[model samples]
Target: MLRVGKKTAEDTQTPNNEIESSVTEWSEKVTSLLWLINADHILPQSYVPEGLENLPNSNVQVVEEAGRAFVRMTQNMDEPLYVANGYISATAQQNLYESKRQQYLEEGYTEERASMVIVDEYFPGGADEHQLGLTFDVCTDAALNLDVDFGLTPQGQWLEEHAWEYGFIFRGAEGAPKIYKPWQLRYVGETHAAIMEKLHLSLDEYLAYLEDKGTSYFSDVGAMHLDLIVYFTDSLSEIPLKIREVSGDNNGHYIVVCYR
Candidate 1:
């Protein structure tokens, strides 16, 4: 498990001038958009995203904001992008795990090796990002399947350069641990996406970094004119400004970002 930090808002420092705004200005829905989900931070089986919208020409569904951003991304690109995977439920994930595990066993692999392979390739049930409607795997018509080779293609290259603008991050990019599928992208909104990309941090590392610091600030990122004040806290009452975004670290704290 990742180490959880215990920094409270009172322990952190903000700039001399704080933004005078109300925390209720931003919707509570922003909280779930950037949630850190993985094996160590498993998603609950009962969890399901609100207002999921179906992407065009795909069986997959994603949150409305993510779906809209994806549409914008596709429209801006010269070639078409397709959703290869999105929003897998716990039951569906179990089926996929069993299928792959059985295939490995059929290939004369031992039970332990088969299980290990499954864990590396596919997370079981509630432990996967696929269970979250905010994550998606993309591919082009020529490359319907996800693989490292797709990263060499025009679609992948374009996404690498511009996905953050649409609030998506390449989840399996460099510095990411375990399975590294270049096609996997997770929605964390534009501001945080820009910050994560700038720091070259995977979601896991980024969360841990912020937790250690207790607080951070950024200016003029992603066409956002106002300065951003970000901090980690387990208690909501400790935040000093209007919370623009709040994401659970999944390790006992909320990563709060506010604008001034």
Candidate 2:
């Protein structure tokens, strides 16, 4: 098992000017990549992920970084990987939400129950991660379907074991509001994904883990022996000037990642 290193307050005495400079230098693009999206943190209808591009040989779109990672992952796989679904537009998500809601209603569920079911089972519009362009559903070329059965396939097994090396995490693996999707992957960057996989933490659990710790350090991540310095705080001034990335935790807080 990979061990997390001891936490330290090494930067506590850093000058205020440095911290402020960090805030100004931090890339907003990096900060937005991992924003948590759920019922409680629903995105606005006008929200759209920037720099979306078509995945190689597929019409499905995702953020440019995510697309590049996805391509690299598939190229390394034995059996070809296929995208079952990718980025969803706000309007399309709303339509899908209505369609599922109506279907549940037709199945004899009350209006209120239908809404609740969809919100829980099928995300409603802006409440979905698909709208973020950082999530994608994958399947093998042999069976182009999305289901739990895919988890048993060679492609799925490969992803489960090695996707973190390429920066993807198995979403909803072990947390609340669980939808139990084995075929879905979300790009949270290589460092974060490595930590999450090593610790067997779901996205929610990972965020909560960092929040509880305030700051954490991990050494020798993967074969690269990379040292990771992670910090969770709402104060922008606390962000280090030389950050690898920053992401919103969907709880009015920010997660800052640095390499040491």
lDDT by residue (tens digit), candidate 2, 155-260: 8888888999998998845312657878889998887888888888888888889999999998888658788888988876756566877887766888888887
In angstroms, the error of model 1 at 65 is 1.1
TM per prediction: 0.85, 0.86
lDDT of 2 at 251: 69
- In TM-score terms, candidate 1 sits at 0.85
- Superposed by TM-score, candidate 2 places the C-alpha of residue 96 at a distance from the truth, in angstroms, of 0.9
Q: Which runs of model 2 end up more than 4 angstroms from their true locations?
A: 1-19, 27-29, 141-143, 173-178
Candidate 1 CA-lDDT value: 0.78
How many backbone clashes are present in model 1? 0
Which pairs of residues have clashing backbones in candidate 1?
none
| lDDT score of residue 119 within candidate 1 | 78
